[model samples]
Target: MIVENSKVILSVKNLTAEVEGVQILKGVNLEVKAGEVHAIMGPNGSGKSTFSKVLAGHPDYAVTGGEVIFKGQNLLELPPEERSRAGVFLAFQYPLEIPGVTNSDFLRLAYNTLQKQKGLAELDLLDFDDYVQDKLKVVEMNPSFLSRSVNEGFSGGEKKRNEILQMAILEPKLAILDETDSGLDIDALRIVSNGVNQLSTAENCTVLITHYQRLLDYIVPDFIHVMESGKIVLTGGKELALELESRGYDWITEEVKV
Candidate 1:
């Protein structure tokens, strides 16, 4: 469903950021258009995660320079909550477990918050339950999850599925999944990837930050970007993933040094 010449959903211009006074993202530039999926890949400290966090407005990371424009607005200007309401979704690598909040309540609150942003009526409990049931199917999650605490006592895969459920309900214009494939078994990976694929559409953009190419096997990206020392040193078509898998990142890093 990728439309050629679609509107740009995210634009990062010479972005530089740091955490705890140490630089992470340096001179990073990327552009994502509607309907396109992009994957960011590199070694452990390549700043792939930092880029995603900075996009989500993580306070820990300070933007020392550059700008991020989302949907034609200065992305860095909006607070975190406002970013979420503006249809920016970030599925964390490690989703936190809330001990007291029930899944149903948390999901409803999030959905209603977005509804309020749009000046739409919020769905009540019964109506919301019906609405959520449909969204749960996207992740093939069970209704029993609603009764449990948000991500509490859930398996790793279940936690990831829960994140996807949130994405299904919110239907954000831009979805940034940071290392979502981490700590997942084959079955879990397949299920989660399928859920992500189901949620993708012609009007939304997906950015996946991953290490292994296996994840890309399931959720093929239109472009694959390689980050080295806080910069996107290389970008290519889906075939780049296979090359990286076969040759490892040494070639890419070495080429970057040239």
Candidate 2:
């Protein structure tokens, strides 16, 4: 269980954002402490995915107002690459395919880039091969995956597993998995959720952006929040997820208005 006294790792205050002149996030405020797992759930168009992208410094989204502070530094001030190097990882819902780049090469490049940024020793090909092999076990992946092009011909589950594999190798402080449960089968979901649960620690945090409560069963969150109209309308504990799953989100939205 996460303690309340843990230091805040992420602070968002009245964060408003837009994409292509359309406002998506309206004054979103959230605080994430070390060791905490936060689940953001809502219906379609509630801006759950947008919040994840904005945190990662996506180029298309414009920050119209407010600020984000991560690890005592201005997060919005950092570029996307800097954000990743600074230990902020965003796992996209639809993992992209890089047909030309080998998976091992891609992971090694990313890991080495972060290592260099932190003044740590860079791993050579031989060293990285040994290192990544251990991480592949986190997702039950085979060595053959390392030789294949990045997500080139991978199935949906394979792609998600590859994303988690990257997260394991990078070891980010705050990992935001945006709808990772999407398009996954029971077996795939279990593998992905187990990987996530194993990776979460007292020193790191995870933010899960999802619509279904089923994912929460495997990787339970310390806090569950409901998003509506681009804002976090309600926050609660794990039981809230069960409530949302049973009764739907209308009751919460209606209560908020009253």
Candidate 3:
């Protein structure tokens, strides 16, 4: 539940973006307040992923028009790294594999970097190990995975767990998870969703971009949005997911057109 007078963490106003000269997000507008969880659902090619990418400041997508404000600042002016530092995190749909970097090292570096930016003391390797170990419990990750290369040869479930581990450590103010439930079996999905629920608090916001209602079953959203073509045409409470799941997007699309 959102607190009384909870501040808005993110606001997108008439946000339009494109990739390689082709428009993907067209006049997207959203208001996410602290303590809210929002789910954006749509059919294929409806620009759900593109919206997340654009919010993360992906270089390939150019903002043609509109504004994105985060924490009272112009989000569009910040580069990706700066946005990360400012507590905006985007969990990729497909977590990348880095063959040379150990998961522990990569996580520590990222955690320490954010600490340094905040003018806080950085933890030594030993200290970071203990800190990250505690975070691993959020996702039920094993300690052995820490020594292995980052997501190298990790199964789909492991990769997704590692992503949650990253989130647990960094503790961003806003987390945008793009298709995070993809390619996971039931058990993995439950584990990941539980971690996300543990991480959510009254001070942070979460935006989940997905294509199915199963994900919402685990990580319930305060609001559900339907995107058609390149825009969100409908917004409803969690019950809307059930409606969409039963009747499909055709009815929503047709309703919007009418």
Candidate 4:
């Protein structure tokens, strides 16, 4: 399927993938539009991360069935870098450490690469430094972070802040944050959420893939979807998250099994 200019940015219908033929997602379906935030919640091993990886074109997870359409094109047909250049960004749950590369350099590479993908000119050293400084302010990161290696020796909070820094700079059309709220203190959570809020608008969409509702308290989503086994069994507004927080997944599992 091909689209020239579509309003729906992402469409995942019956998306199924596997690791070494071990099925993960089963008939999963989701859609995201610009200017909205959608949250995916599930128990352990529920394929939440698999869904993110598949969307991002991770080589290890084989797409055994289903389709993913992003920005009017079949996403699986593109390479991971290509997908990212097309305005799809996935914030990793565990960011890696680059020993030799300073955070500033890595951010510049990512920013310039994204701009190049848009057929825009790359930022010079001066422009790049200014750009990153603005983004750091968005995440409330310390000014000294620029001198450090990419996440080397960063505390849990610092690592998460650095992730947010990337999100703010990229300004992706679709941002999939994988467990972004984990390992953050209250102040850090607020700072990260505040950054996301400042960046989010009606023209950009965000997907918060998380297990706890605590994060939702800060970055309230427009939709909350609960995944179990492999499929999404419940879809509701933010209230559903509060309900789940009080009653647990047992309620939904019992209802579905009955």
Candidate 5:
């Protein structure tokens, strides 16, 4: 578990959202600070993924109520692109394949866009090539991946690696990994976890949304939260994950109801 002096990076207050006219998140509240990793775990339909998407300002979900503050700004008010430029990153469970765009080009464009937003000069192609090469080492990805189309024909592990590689280059202040460990084998899981650990620092925070306790083993979290029926019903330290893994969520759910 990581600790900090307690500078809040994200503060969600009674966050309520819905998708396609169906309510999903129900007043979800959470607080994350720099230098800490928070894991949100729960069964299916618990609205874990919905919360992550809402933070990223996804278009499909509409915020019906509540407030979200990220780095002292009204997060819900920002557009998706603005959120990305503001150092909010989301590594999706399913990375899309862009057939026409090469990975190098895509990454460079994304990186340069964020750089421009930060009032930093955009790297030219020549300099960006050198920069991306260095980031590839973070994920231990092969150079050939840069030449191929984005996520095209890559294995499951490869796609996840690419997502981490993007995080490496982007250096986001808040990284939300939405079940990035879902389909990865043990080896890939370690590799991905290593990258995430390497990137985490006192200046940034990480939020992991996962279903299994296995991921918590590799990336130890400072806080473990149990989400059920669109709300966080319990919060504890790392040991809570082990408890949930052994006892299952039923007992916790029943206890919360009582």
Candidate 6:
């Protein structure tokens, strides 16, 4: 039985989805509780990105079966915009650049758009600006980020930090990050991870989808799940990431029947 007010915030049961009629997710199941970080580690072509996309209501993929419940709500039934308004946040691997959209304009609209969905009043430009300045301090980001177009001409490091900055401001109940450690130098990784860590609280959860164990060192997920062929084959604590790093995914691949 699933509880409406349980500590588990998101419940995914026997989830199966597809892209253009080709099945991608084959009965994937996961349970995420508040304040917990779950790292999904898998090899390339293992359907990690598919899982992230399906959760965000991307139309390119179709749900073949299963249920996704978020805080007692049917998540799959909602549209992508509604999904964002309802608290699902996905940080993309390759962020698109909008040359005309100012970063500050985008952030302000995103924050207030969410606020409106919750039946709360929207924050004016002044209030939102103040809030953004404070969040930038957390990532050691500069004020110049506000004036630039959204992700336009941003370095790899700047783009990742910008994603974290949005996460910090939106404060979604469930945040799904896909390969966030990619293209990041040591300093940028530290700054981005630090921002992510600071955003976590007793009321929110973080889900990291990554291929390498290097990211686990900074984020320190509460659970590590190994995915192969769209299903979780192994699960353990932080040490599992280390073990995978030592022995490699070969152990999991060899054990899994495919």
Q: Each model's C-alpha lDDT?
A: 0.95, 0.95, 0.94, 0.88, 0.94, 0.90
Clashing residue pairs in candidate 1, if any? none
TM-scores, all models, native as reference: 0.99, 0.98, 0.98, 0.95, 0.98, 0.96
Candidate 2 colliding pairs: none
Model 3, 1-258: lDDT tens digits are: 456799999999998999999998889989999999999999999999999999999999999999999999999999999999999999889999999999999998999999999999999999998898789899999999999999999999999999989999999999999999999999999999999999999999999999999999999999999988888899999999999999999987788789
* Model 1 residue 170 distance off true place after TM-score fit, in angstroms: 0.6
Global local distance difference test of model 1: 0.95
| Arranged by lDDT, best first | 1, 2, 5, 3, 6, 4
lDDT of 1 by residue, 180-241 (tens): 99999999899999999999998999999999999999999999999999999999999999
Per-residue C-alpha lDDT of model 6 across residues 1-258, encoded as one tens digit per residue:
112464987899999989988887898899999888999998888889999999999999999999999978999999999988888999988887989999999999989888887889998988888888999987889989899999999999899899989988888999999999999999999999999989988888889999999888899998899988888888998899988988989889989975
Better of 1 and 2 by lDDT: 1
5 versus 6: better TM-score goes to: 5
Task: State, as a TM-score between 0 and 1, how close model 2 is to the true structure.
Answer: 0.98
How would you encode candidate 5's per-residue C-alpha lDDT over 1-258 as one tens digit per residue? 366476899999999999999999999999999989999999899999999999999999999999999999999999999998888999998999999999999999999998888899999999999999889998899999999999999999999999999999999999999999989999999999999999999999999999999999999999999999999999999999999999999997798789
Once fitted onto the true fold, the runs of candidate 2 whose alpha carbons sit more than 4 angstroms away are none
Superposed by TM-score, candidate 4 places the C-alpha of residue 253 at a distance from the truth, in angstroms, of: 1.9
Worst 10 residues of 2 by lDDT: 249-258
lDDT of 1 at 172: 97
Worst 10 residues of 1 by lDDT: 1-10
**Total residue pair clashes for candidate 1:** 0
Quality of model 6 by C-alpha lDDT = 0.90
Query: Residue 132 lDDT in model 5?
Result: 91
Candidate 3 vs 6: which has more TM-score = 3
